[model samples]
Target chain A: MTIDALEQRLTDLAFDRPDAGRVTARVLSLARKRRRRAVARLGALAAATLLIAAAVVYFVPAADAVLADTPIAGDLLRSAGLTGAGNRVTAVGAVASSSGFRLQLVGAYADSTRTVLLLRANPAILPLGPPSLDPQLSDQFGRTYHVQSELTDSRTGQVIIEFEALAWPDALTGARIALKVTTLKRACASAPFCTDPVSSEPMVRGSWTLRATVGVDESTPLALPAPAHLGPATFNFTSVRSSLATIGIEMSVKGATFDDLQQRVADGRKGTPVFTIDLFAPNGDTATASYSLGEDQRGPLIQFLGYRFGPGNYRLHISYRGSDVDRLLTVP
Target chain B: MEAALTLSDAATAALTPDELCRRYAPSVCRFAGMIAGSSSDADDLAQDALLRAVRAIHSYDPSKGSPEAWLWRIVVNAGRDSARRRERTRWIVERLAFTAPRESESVEAAVLARLRDADLHAQLRLLPHRDKTLLALRYGVGLDTAEVGAAVGLSTDSTGKAIRRALARLRARLEVTRP
Candidate 1:
């Protein structure tokens, strides 16, 4: 059949129309439950924090020393600065073995915006090189989360996989999460330069599923200033979500058409705008932008990871084409 | 409440979650069904996309594009994710030598079976995921090239070229499958 004929047939196909009211009710119900859970979790965390503080005075030193010895934990401590971030990290100790490989879900550090899962594979799978891991994550609510990026530490054979929820039910606190990995194929022959695996490479073809309960972390939303003017664009700082692990900034840019934004994205695969955002901690430490999560007409949502900002004010400096503006932000 | 009010602008105030679902859920479901090849999968995909849109409604800016384009982008991502999950499950089943029954006979499969165009349906199914998505957006959802490009994060020219290429591939596959 011709393409036009196929298109016509597709348009005429008998597709079932779902009940809009039912769908909307279901969506709203889930959203409400998630919001309620988040609020309740925050309250409980506050109470728990008081109790944990007394307990941590006795146990934190030993715990820190032990974590400092491990390669993955040391890296996490340096990168995310998750030390003593109350209940932000969970120790999952679930293990599954398949096809001569033992995989352990060591633990996870989660905030409002993302979850970083620490997994260790026995037999040192990464000593030779990096491998492509096909992992699928789903929670008790049947909400699936996508893996944004994966970092492997060859020294400990541990994998750090970061997940971002692109839909509702983003709250993972106290929810049962199952992570299933079906295949692990060697993607590269070398350590740093990992390319696609050739067909001849050996592939591990079995399933390893680990389940864990995610701990809660504080995600505080900061009050943003009014829209700022940058040449040819009006940048409205819509929202700023801060947590120990990451800070997410959402803005809407006016006076720039969607085509203009798309062209800028085309010019740079990073898709970041022609501007820079810098976060300066109270201790003179700085955290750089982690990723630019794609921009649309609504503007770009950027994430800054790593650098622990204690309960103090931070300076957010923005620069666009030689013009600079700074805003002081408070982190509770 | 105050934070919500501060976040509200002309773009977000224009459409609430209730209005969005009431107006666009049907079309979203239809588009999802076409891409997922099953009504049941479509239901799940549509719900996921709508809930995502609702939670993220504060980020929607009308000046960026039409609400339809914004929502369709969510739908497209949801569909792609579902497809990846299905592929993984299929891979596991094949590896285990397990004969898992089909989730359900998809609407497209049923219609093609009735019309004795099962070969054409099979050919369509064999197309790459990206090609199928483009075809579904352009033909199944009746989106123009520009709308499809907006949803998929491509330039209009790129979207048009991709759709034409997908059509050509489908035609070639159908020819090969014919007796």
Candidate 2:
């Protein structure tokens, strides 16, 4: 018989084993045990991880939303609750740990923002001392301030969440406090552009302000003049695939030409002279469909990998350092 | 949609691990029975393949295509890995021998041969490792040209044309002494 015929006969023969069911069960049991062991091993490894030790941080819950968890300290807060702010916080802290613990809470309107007041009247019980600088408190501004903060010092102030920090002392002056809220960034979880996986490389992932416009238009071919810093700067491409979504881009520094950008990715991760990417919408503005790139290879011949974001109209802006073509891209 | 099976077949699919053995245990044994001396390796590989399928069921999107094709891919790859590992541990020095066996010692001489043909294995070993792999992916595991390209890092256009040339060569060699 032919080899194909013989193979078919063998497949048929496989179905004839009277004891096959009994055998498969034993194999399955063994597999289950193996998987369980793997899961337990992984769980043990995760428990040993130290990085997550103090990451309980989130955007400071909005003052409007903070009442759910705040304590009803200080009589001033109680009076506000009586008048209507549900839970009143005349002070942001309290006094006493364990022994002889008595909390005296008072609130009085002073600053524009309502405040939490906690007084450990029993000095023996150890009231919270003066507001000292919490060196660990970061001054980084996020996209939104869900301020989970307590201004222990009367001089507390918030700004418009700017790129630069407004001086603490500058924010406080007598009866008024300024919210120097500069635009800090918190990448929206549901933000249309947040599909990029969170990675720990110092290179920022999600989104950034573009120095120029870049995207697609109905008639014009993407006419990005070569970036000024084109010589041999490096760049990256990162993407993911699941469901039906697909996205990909090749970023390179300016002046190197499109051929140069393509060649860089073709040579893999190590091909250098840095570059960056910008995507624009139909109206010549940054679109929600943007992300950073990463490499999936080790050596010079590594494959160029990127996410496949289904189907849509898109354009790209290439940025390279120290060159005329650096920001030469303009959106249609 | 769940596949509706006959009473016996339905029972087989739904069978408990122990019952699954009672029903289809022989299929694995027979499948394993060919290349192996005893049923142990067959049982082991078959069990492993099935277990993997069961565990990966949650992640298996049926929309991709046939589950059987997917399962078989895993099975064949597993088998190849096992073979390579065993090759290492045993370290059998199979010195290259180009000559064919005498024509007189035909299929007539070995009716109960475990394998389909010894010549097939010998000629397969003669191929470069990459070609051998292409053969396994194309025929043994039954991947289409596009799928094979993805696995072997070849473009689809190249894989199909290359596989055709490679397979034709092997088929011709096998048919040389045939009627």
Candidate DockQ scores, in order: 0.14, 0.14
Off by over 4 Å in 1: A1-71, A80-87, A125-133, A166-173, A186-202, A258-273, A293-307, B1-179
Per-residue lDDT tens digits of candidate 1, residues B70-157?
8789888877766764665455543453222222224333333344334454455556668878987887678899999999999999
**Model no. 2, DockQ:** 0.14
lDDT per residue as tens, model 2, A164-254: 1122332242222222211211212121222221243212212112111111111212333321222343232221111111122333322
List the pairs of residues colliding in candidate 1: A297-B64
- Cα misplacement distance, residue B73 of candidate 2 (Å): 0.8
- Model 1 CA lDDT for position A152: 50
Tens-digit per-residue lDDT, B107-158, candidate 2: 4223324434444544444443445556655654446777777655678999
Taken over the whole model, the C-alpha lDDT of each candidate is: 0.59, 0.32
State candidate 1's TM-score: 0.44
TM-scores for every candidate against the unseen true structure = 0.44, 0.26
Give the fraction of true interface contacts kept by model 1. Answer: 0.37
